[model samples]
Each structure stands twice: as structure tokens, then as C-alpha cells.
Target: MQPDQVSIATQGLLKGRRVLVTGGARGLGLEFARHAGRAGAAVVIADILANELHAAAEDLRAEGIQAQSVVFDQSSPESITDCVVQAAQWLGGLDGLVNNAAITNSGGKALNELDIDVWDKVMAVNVRGTWLMSRACWPALKASGRGSIVNLASDTSLWGAQNLLAYVASKGAVIAMSRSMAREMGVDNITVNAVAPGLTLVEATEYVPKHRHELYEGQRAIQRQQVPDDVSGVVTFLLSDLSRFVTGQVMAVNGGFVMH
Candidate 1:
């Protein structure tokens, strides 16, 4: 049973596409890379965690998928530029970019008691990193002529959450930036969109207090928590030709947690 023999609805949806997924070493990013690779896309798993990225790539390759790993630091503008260049060179040009790298910390205090340093770090990684990555990949995306960009946003961006002001604010910026990018790139045939996940149980959310976790659980009409697989499908759709007519939209995969 070879990978090419696997039967799937979106089989070979990206047969000749080259995809670069930032922060793809683990968790949701890893899931995205796996799905895209399985769908016959040549995936470049870029992450700051070099060891893990290499391992993930190897695992994919073992499954007969065209996958590679590159060391990348999304938070640094220079690093992001270098990464995009290397990735484009390695993949022979990019068709899709996943801006999924972000930093999140539990700011236990309210606005008055918040640490300025933590706030800066959060914004730097989430907002600034996303912007830099998108800009660096702009030329390659334009060249692809059917390019797509998906930014990982959070449900908090749509609605405010207490004590997590920095994360919320950064995601809000992601949504806005994505919309603007979509408009700017539409003429180039590059679609930009955002995926907002509501309280997904990923490594990034481990620090969230139990009460806060419960809050999300209670809000979900489905009465179930979200998993990485829950969000990966929508991401794949947005990156595939199925979404060619879709742009500047924020797709939520929160299991009925957030209607918006």
C-alpha cells in the first residue's frame, strides 16, 4: 500500500505545489504539514526547533512523501528573510505559506499588573513575525500565480478574553493583516486567509489555567474539546484549489465553540 495508492477526497490536491509551514515541528503545525504532504504537496517544515523539524521531515519521507525541514526563526526579520529564501530555493518556489509560529504566555495579571516585557515578546512573535514572514514570501507567492497564505489566528481575536490581552491583541492584528493582504494579493492570484481556532488543546495552550479551559469547554455547543486534526482540514482546504474562490475569510474550526 503506497502513499500514491491511498484513497482520499482531496487526493493529489497539491500534486506539484510547494508548501512552507512555519512552526511545523510539532502540534498543529505538524498536523498541517502531514495532511498537506499526504495530499501530495512537497512540504517544507520550517521551525526554530531544528532537531524536531528534521525528525518530522524524516517521518514524512518514510511515508513516501516529499518533505523537507529548514531551521527558521520567525520572530527575527533577518532570519525570516533568510528562511524564505532558502525554502524557496530548496522547493524551487513556493505555492503556499502557513504563518503558524507564535508565542503565548499566561499573563496572570490584568492590564495594570501586566509585564511590559512579556507583552512585547508576545506581539513581537505573533504580529511582527507573521508580518515579516508574509512579506518575505510575497515575491515567491506572486510568482506561483496560484499562491495561498493561511495565518493561524485564535478565537480570542474575535472576542476579548480576560488576562490574555497580548495574545488576543496579536491575533486580532493577524485577522486584520490577513484581510489587507488578501486584498493586496488578489490581483496577483494569491489568496490570503486566516484560521481561528477556539481553545484547541495544543502545546501552546498548556499554560492556560484550568478554569479558562473549562470556560471554553462550556461555551462549545458540541460539548467537546478541539484537537489538532479538527483544525487541519480547514487549513488544507484553504491551501487547496477547492478554496480558489475563497479569500480574506477567517474559517473557524472550534467545534461550534465560536459561531463567528
Candidate 2:
């Protein structure tokens, strides 16, 4: 279904905003783009997946939303710089960013069993990539006068999920980095915050074991598997003026699974 074909009851919270989401061609990133578009923002979806990226953007355009897609490697500085510039050009301006691209399940092994190559690759993409994207978008964000950033973190970073040491560490770093970035960006009137979602059932997590799913579901006070929409709404709010005073915080959208 097209975007307009769906309910648009966001009250135009993000109207007149231009937002970009990394890894936005699939999974949770795509959901963020969907919500942003419905909230009345012109959105740009960037990802390394060429075909899916184009299709995702077309999906938005079919709904009469101003949307575009770009393919670039989050791990490559040159690619990130060029992509941000291209995204700003596509939207005619930039107001918000969703750093939702990151590597997880890098071997899915214990820290002692993890390969150095896998660890490095995860850090490069998950940690270093977020840094690069944020830096590249700094100028455009400042220009918006109502700049906002929502970094994707994980509940594992807060409550320690086993066998995913690298992902947990990377997200922990994201949480830390967001606090520092908020302190700095507040001078530019840009709010920087991280959304640490629990075990959300997105397309990327379709391979998750049934028992593992049950475990997460059972742990949640809501007693159900979390979905992308569960987190997307919070991200949309952060990107909108409704959350202007909220920054440097890690809002967990885990259905009370890992309350902090």
C-alpha cells in the first residue's frame, strides 16, 4: 500500500522537515523513513542495497511523498561524505538524520571466540560509520535551525545480551557518543539522542530462533514481540519539534523488557 493509503494521523509533527535515514532500504531503517514521510517530512533513504533502496524510495513516491534513495557504504568515509551531500541536494535541505545502519551478529560468538576481522568490520561499520555520517551532516543539520539526530542503539548495550559482545559494545559506544554529541550539538540547536530498542522483529531478524523470540517476548512486560513500528514512533517524535527539549538520552523502546 502507498503511504497516503495508510493512516497519516501523526498531526504533521515533522512537516517541512527534510530527513535522511541510513540503511533505510530495509528493516527498522525503512520503518523510520515510512513514519517520517507520513509525518510530513521529505525523506531520503540511503543504503548499500541498490535494488531494495530504489524500490523503497519508489514505494514512498508512489504515495506522493517526496522521497529518494542513495546507495553508499557506511564504512567508507568517501562514500558517506558523498552520500550526505547527495541526500541534502535531493531534499533541498536537511533537518534530521537517523543513523540506523549497523552491523550485528558478527559471528554471533562469545568475545573469546570472535574473530579479529569480524570485530574490526563490526566496529568500522557500526561505530565509525555513525561517527562519519554525523560529522558529514553537521553543516546541513546546523543550517536547519531545528536539527535532530536519532542514533540506533540496542538494549543489549544496556542489559548485556550474551554471545553478541561486539554488537553490544558498539551500541554502548553509540550511547556514549550520542551524549557527547548532544553536548556539542546543543550549541547549534540540534538535539542528539539514541533509541535503544530491544529484540524488535524486523525483516533483518526473521532468522531469529523461535525459542529466542519466545524468550524476549516473555521477558517483556507487554508479553509480545516488538515490531519496527514500536520503535519508529519514538524516532519520529525525536525528529519532530515535539521532542525539542529531549536530548542526550537513550530511550528504550523495548516494552519494559530492560527498564533502566
Candidate 3:
């Protein structure tokens, strides 16, 4: 099954693969699911938003793509566990995981004005949630014999954004954890990597100010706004045979906003 919007040559790029994407009902996650499906992977998108999740899945199905959506709560261990198990069952097995689910809160809140509850909530969803999802999918991933994991970080963490200390700190932890995750998962032929994307205009990012978009565009060498599609292809590559030998790397998809 494939989507009519975009076509891909399905010559084992992602053939016979099964992948699970968290926070995938819309925005970046939705794009990933669509692109991956086109590439020949059986894609499952999990998100906390039930109505949106079902709608996204139906859209894919309408395009002849076999897609599934599960209700996911990143901060809940039981939710993560059950979601992974069900996704694996639905797909027959697991081959890849995209930890794309994260909460950015309101972008501009300085530490002095930031609430403790907000900070803790950000950490719980971004940092701890990724770890929990990876752990829960470990066995099924190991069984794939060539499993891939993609954790979504952000450019804010890479080049430090003002008024987002908690989020930046959490993603920094994601970068730090990627190395260890790769080290451990390598033993099972599962590659672990993190992707840091610039501000992209998606449903989840509707709260971003217009000035911020202009600032990002002005700062980037590409001189354009980053879209959800810009970030999906790289992720599909990371989850394909192409990146079999690649791991422990953080690819910044910010159009040169944060170059390492």
C-alpha cells in the first residue's frame, strides 16, 4: 500500500519493514508515516490525540496505505508498553521506531518565569518518555535483527534557545543518551540516532510567532521556512538499509540554523 501524494521506488529501500512512530497523528510524525509508507514500510503512528490519530490513519488508508494509529501517552509507562506491544502485533514484527513525540510547551518562557511543574512535565515527556519507549520496544527491536531507532531532538537544544531552558536541557540529554543507546543497541544490530529539526510550521507549532519564523528563515542558509516534509526523508533514510552502518549520530535538519 502507498500514498498517491508522493511515490517512491519500493525496491527494498524499506520493503517488508515494520515501524512505529510516536506522536505521529499530525505534523512531523504524520509526514514520517506517509513517507515511510511510500517507501514500503508497514507504518503505525501512535499519538495521544484520539480524534486526530484516527483521522490520520483513515487518510492514509484512503491513499491505499496500510496505516494504524494507537492512542499513546508518552509519560505513562503502561501506555508506552501496551502501545508498543500492540503495534508489534499489528505489524507482525518491529523493525524501526521513531521517537518523534515531544512537548515544546509555549516556546518563550525564561527560567525565572518558568513554573517547576512545567519543567518537570517537559522532562517527563521529552527525556524520560523517549527512554521508556526505547526500552519497551527493545525486545521486538532486537528481534528484527536490524532495528533502527530515531529520537526527535530539536535545534533549540543544539544552539541554545532563550526562554526554553527546560526543553533545551531535555534534548541535550537526548543527544547525550543517543551515544549510550547506540552503544547498547549496537549489540543487537539496532542503530540509535537523534534528529534535531528547526522550527517547522506544523499543526503542533501553530503557536509559534510569525517573527520567530522570519528569524529562523533569515538565519538559515537556505533562506526558507522548514516544513514537515523537509524532515521526513532523512528519517526514512535513517530507518532504512541505507543507514545500517550509521548510529550514535545527531543529524540537524535546520537548513543550517545550527551547524556542527
Over 83-190, each residue of candidate 3 has an lDDT whose tens digit, in order, gives 999999999999999999989773688789998888899899999999999999999999999999999998888898898899899999999998899999999999
- Ten-residue region with minimum lDDT total, candidate 2: 2-11
Q: Residue 258's C-alpha lDDT in candidate 2?
A: 91
- Give per-model CA RMSD: 2.4, 1.6, 1.9
Judged by lDDT, which candidate is best? 2
**TM-score of decoy 1:** 0.94
Tens digit of per-residue lDDT, candidate 1, span 99-199: 99887773666877778898898889999999999999999999999999999999887778777888889999999999999999899999999999988
Question: Which of candidates 1 and 2 reaches a greater TM-score?
Answer: 2
* CA lDDT, candidate 3, residue 115: 87
Assess each prediction's global lDDT (C-alpha) against the native. Answer: 0.87, 0.90, 0.90
Per-model TM values vs. the true structure: 0.94, 0.96, 0.96
